[model samples]
Target: MTAALSPSESELRETLAQVLPAVRADLEDLVRIPSVYADPARAADVQRSAEAVARLLREAGFAQVDVVSEGGAPAVIAHHPAPPGAPTVLLYAHHDVQPTGDVTAWTSPPFEPTERGERLYARGAADDKAGIAAHLAAFRAHGGAPPVGVTVFVEGEEESGSPSLTRLLHTYRDRLAADAIVIADSANWDVGVPALTVSLRGLADCVVEVRTLGHAVHSGLWGGVAPDALTTLCRLLATLHHPDGSVAVAGLPQGEAADLDYPEERVRAESSLLDGVQQLGTGSVVSRLWNGPAIAVIGIDAPTVAASSNTLVPVARAKVSLRVPPGTDAHAALAALTEHLRSHVGWGAQVTVTGGETGQPCAIDASGPAYDAARSSFRDAWDGTEPVDMGMGGSIPFIAEFVDAFPDAAVLVTGVEDPDTRAHGVDEGLHLAEFERVCLAETLLLARLARG
Candidate 1:
């Protein structure tokens, strides 16, 4: 049973209101840095972002702040000891942001935070930079001294698939140890709704090349007699899905998702699905999106329409991405994709499949006292709105790494994003009002955990 908020809660609300302006300013400063670790040109910017985060933590009353690296992008670690008999909590976020896709498509500059209506638009505004800001807000709301122990670990390469995460985890295991770990890099249910991510789909990708001939030939001469690599590649890709759009790959397992009311209208509105475009798969919309495996052709190595000629291409390549559901192995999923590509090709086309990165899916058991405290805190912050349990179609493989390195810690996947955040897409944004609630929820969570 939940109890009434104490006087301290009210005090915290007042304190947060006072500190929020500075927090938003700091968040804007953070969003201004193009810290895309995946881009070689932005390496220096990534380092700068890490340094800025370290400085912020130090200013927020963390006496011990260190910028560390594991042969990759720099990550910040800060510590504030817990009060006697209180549990320590670890806060996790990432400073790295995805590369802005097309500058012309943005309503404003991608690096410049702009307020339109009730949201702030920028490249890292919601994806994760707000996560860093949220942590700072909570820390400052307590006057830089909360009841529980606090350790902040802001990663710098999450957008780069966390290439050095395993090494970082192994090297900093002692300093990062905590009773509860909050990974603030997910999406909430909606603008005013809150959610705790209970499961995450894993990721696997590969490049498949199809060769139909040794050299390009005139299309007129080989129009009907010989197949072009591009046509053959298209045919092979078509085999990856059935008429109903479910994955046709063999040996893939289907998992279960939360029985939430995700109607077709909501899905279409969120995804911007075109009118009359039928939905994919046969099961519930949430199940297809969050539980079953999904495959997409992200990119293709073919001549552009403007550069096209009447020549039959000898070879063509396409990069395929596969989303593996919870409880499935990413490597196994990649193997299935590779095997399907090789077996489905006709006309004796030579197909070469090259594997890319793979990350394990994660399923969190959100039970016990820590989860209860988190739920209560969220409820209180949202004025009695119950938080929902949801699954993420995207992958955060490092969550599994955290679970593996610290088996006893209760991992809480909170979010600052709503359906319209557009993380990793053009015009990414964060809801101004909802962000305040996120800060309050996290601030209250730390107190509730200390009491437990």
Candidate 2:
């Protein structure tokens, strides 16, 4: 679908252009708050951020705004009723951000919003914080009252696995209900390009411990015959993938072909892969990343080399994360992973696998009136550039819940992050131009939906 810039569209663009500076300032203010939900010490900061979000929603003309907290974390809920027969759109974002690790590695402070060149750099700059800003900007552009009804749902515990989300959903089902949902917590296709995330891989994690000897022994005395737990764990982890890096786990389904071609050079640059290092798995880059299962050793409990002695360690543990493609049950994948780890320990070593969080994959049907409006709105916002149907390798566990809760609603997963955004890492940033386009797209989408 293509966009024709009618007089109304031009007026909306002008309004957004005039309000862009204030929106950016609001984003800067939000980035200044260190709302890290994963850190227990920052619980107050998370609540503070939620209050800020609630204030923003109220200032943006939401009549009913409340901070809902159910023992875990807070969420900002606001509603702007529709005019006549317009559809209600539930806009979702998160106020809490990922923990900023290794402050020395960052070019600037993670909580201090700084602008260099054409980007804004901070911890939550390109993540869901930008998502919140985008929604506010769009709402402001419409003079604080859009044609369509809007429900602003700004979550506060998304970075911490959203343990309270199910309870929140159940308690406030009618308040959060809508005909369409927009999750602004995903990635764009690239800078200056838009994408609709159609599929997302599910996530499963487990912590596996391997035990060999009862106690540490001298390496020289036991090196020839005794097996170390660390060595055994490493060998077992190696069996999770083939030499070509394809997943060796059974019962996991492969993903479908991606709609766009992800170039190797682009992937290397985006991923910051070292020179001469080969990419993992087979098939296209998108297919390997989004269409197939991937295993990652997230953390390991082993003695550091600096503190290590000439001794054989008795116990070792590793945290493993598995990404399952759409259509695969995450719980089943977790079971398979546990079974594989338990049965693969060599030298009769005892192995124990404990399951962690499991999230289901999501696949959306992007062929409906809502999707058509989104495509056209994006085309207009991006200067005639068409939005692509993309898939995200990472999992957003709450998307599945939102889909289940509002089965008939059109779920549009959009975001402000680009290939170089570096979200959840050091020197995270947001492309200013792309963020403006995102606001414009959302504003135009509301207009289109209202017209229909």
Candidate 3:
């Protein structure tokens, strides 16, 4: 790596290339640990991953590296001061991942990094561990520092709602100020395209419950008069969308987005969606994704047909997730959604809704220098593939917080994940070639930003 590297620029590329094995090794180690944020069994694993990130930053020439919070899973932060007049760039990634769901679905252990057909499979490997590795490699090859100032904000609770991120940002706004923030937690447009995430949708999560009776009763005696909470809840959920899949919720604000074709067939093919299911929603992909609202009934607590016999059930609960467009108020939207649910009663049953966090989304100004630098870097890194523009349906939430804190800072959302990369699912993987390319891209981006 050192031999191939002539100047600092080439040196960075060479170092990243040389360190690919080790980087992947580290990524594998990080992935093997189930750092599931919401689960009690994985809290310690999440904390350990945070400590590892902090250690990497410290060893890579960042003098000021420590966990910002006093208790719970720490928010890892590190400062790398640059030469005078250079603008600062804040780098952010998450150390935690969604749990290894349905272990039998994976060919290999979810934590063990295994290579098969150019993919490194593991939980969190694609979603974030690769992101962390790329950033660290870039920082390291800059000879323990970037020419421009850098402040790294790696989170420990992204898999969950990221409850601690906003607090940490508020607690350390001044120190975290930067001219641009790089969020490496999104997927690219596809396997070959280097995508610049221009926008992300806001989010709201809730638990919807229906309790019709004190307990279950014999269907033989109560079938005619008894109110079945589960059946009523299912009917209520059905009203959320029509047969065509468009949202049926009334009063939710929606606006047209700049057209992003997003072929329906392509989405279905890429996502491996069920065969016979029709595409839901209205208008284009960008519209349904970035501007309009979407509701997903993620989970339900009900007795299966096989398990249930002849009983009239009294309780039912379901998890609801909503993605709001940029500029939409999540709290207000939540109120509207819940109100809609309450109004549409199947049996005049009592309903309970437990609200979760409302995370706002962010949009980047692509004409800015930070973006220009990224475009060039990405083109070079991906063997001359034109840089692509896309928006994330999933929200990072911290981007909004970062913007509020650093009013003048530019925001960049580019990462190692891509449309082909299956994230948040079993047998998750990272493309090694793309990982190297992203590290190189960051190196070039940092160099350009430093000079400017």
Candidate 4:
């Protein structure tokens, strides 16, 4: 927690409001660069994004700011020493974003951020560029040189699996230490409703291929006898859930969040489910999404609707995604999911399951001194939006690193992106109004922490 020394609300406003425009401008500049990991063509753009953030930290009165390279993308570190006795707080946000798969679907160009309806339409705007810019707004507003000791960890490769963060933590744990960590990578519960992400669902990815015959047999020749790979794969996938649309996995337990915070109506609206298509999952919204396990067949290697070839597929493969409940061992879940697929063989079809890296989920301790100051700050930042509680379906593997390193640290995840923001999807955007409100909220957190 920050130390005590009162500053008037008017004073805080005077400090924060003046520089907001430039802060937003910087965010726009950040969104222009596409920072997809492993794309050699866009490596320079990611580096530029890294350098831009380092400059922001230096301007924020961090005497020491440098880009620490940890393999994939560089980690931006900025240090500000507090006046004696004040504690250190580490603010975390990512600099990179996912690849803009197709640009034609967007209303505006994906890289060229557009402003019209008080929202900035771009790739990184809501995801993390805005969140990273929010941290700068906080420190630059209250005191360019923060009253409390500060360490800013602006990571790259977050859109990727965050494979580099574990290495970064091990290599530079000393500099990353802080009493509490403020993670600005999550979204608000809804527009104008600020929410801290206390828990996140973990992830396990795999590629499953089912091989039936040696070649694509003509349907006319072997319609009845030919064992179809696609059909077999679908059958194995069908066993994942029961008739009630609940996961039927033998060991993975099922239950709802105690709060039952997210209502079904809200989830339906936010997810934009087709009106005619019935909801597939069972249990409460929180239970199905947050606590229980989910298996989604993301992509399939098969004939397209337009380019259909009337033949039996010799081999069928699917990129499958398995989301585990918070605190579930990812490898354990992966093994179970793999075994389930292998055991459900139909017509003596052979199935091969290959595993990929798994990202662990995080549940932060929000019952401490930091949470108290943050609740007050959130209220002050967003004109009394009455922030609700919500959990995310995605995972940030590095959040686990911080929790493990500083078990006692109050890890709070809040950001400008809201439920409908569409972070990793097509036509992604950020509300400019909410962006500044998040900045104000962050500003208040820093000021309240400084005055503690």
- Lowest lDDT 10-mer window, candidate 4? 1-10
Model 4 steric clash pairs: 2-449, 3-451, 3-452, 4-451, 4-452
Q: Show how many residue pairs clash in every candidate, following the order shown.
A: 0, 0, 2, 5
Candidate 1 structure quality by residue, lDDT tens digits, 140-248: 9999999999999999999989989899888999999999999999989988789999999999999999999999899998889999999999999999999999999
- Per-candidate RMSD vs. true structure? 1.5, 1.4, 3.0, 2.9
Across 143-182, the per-residue lDDT of candidate 4 in tens digits comes to 7866788889999888877887888888888898888799
* Local distance difference test, each candidate: 0.94, 0.91, 0.81, 0.81
**Would you give me the overall lDDT of model 1?**
0.94
Residues 1-452, model 3: lDDT tens digits: 11122277676777767766766777777787778877988777777878888777787779799876734566788898868999988898888888888999999988888999978888888888888888888887677767899888888877777777667777888888888889898878777778898888888888889999899999899988988999889999998887878777776766776755688789898768898877777678777777778899999999997899788889999998888777777788788788878889677799988897688866666777788888888887777788878877778777777777777878888889876677888778888778888888888889989766
The whole-model C-alpha lDDT of candidate 2 against the native structure comes to 0.91
TM-score for candidate 4, please give it. 0.94
Better of 1 and 3 by lDDT: 1
Q: Which ranges of candidate 3 are over 4 A from the true structure?
A: 1-11
lDDT of model 3 at residue 119? 85
The residue pairs found clashing in candidate 2 are none
Candidate 4, residue 42: the lDDT equals: 87
Cα shift from native, residue 289, model 3 (Å): 2.7
User: Which stretches of model 2 miss by more than 4 angstroms?
Assistant: 1-3
Best by lDDT: 1
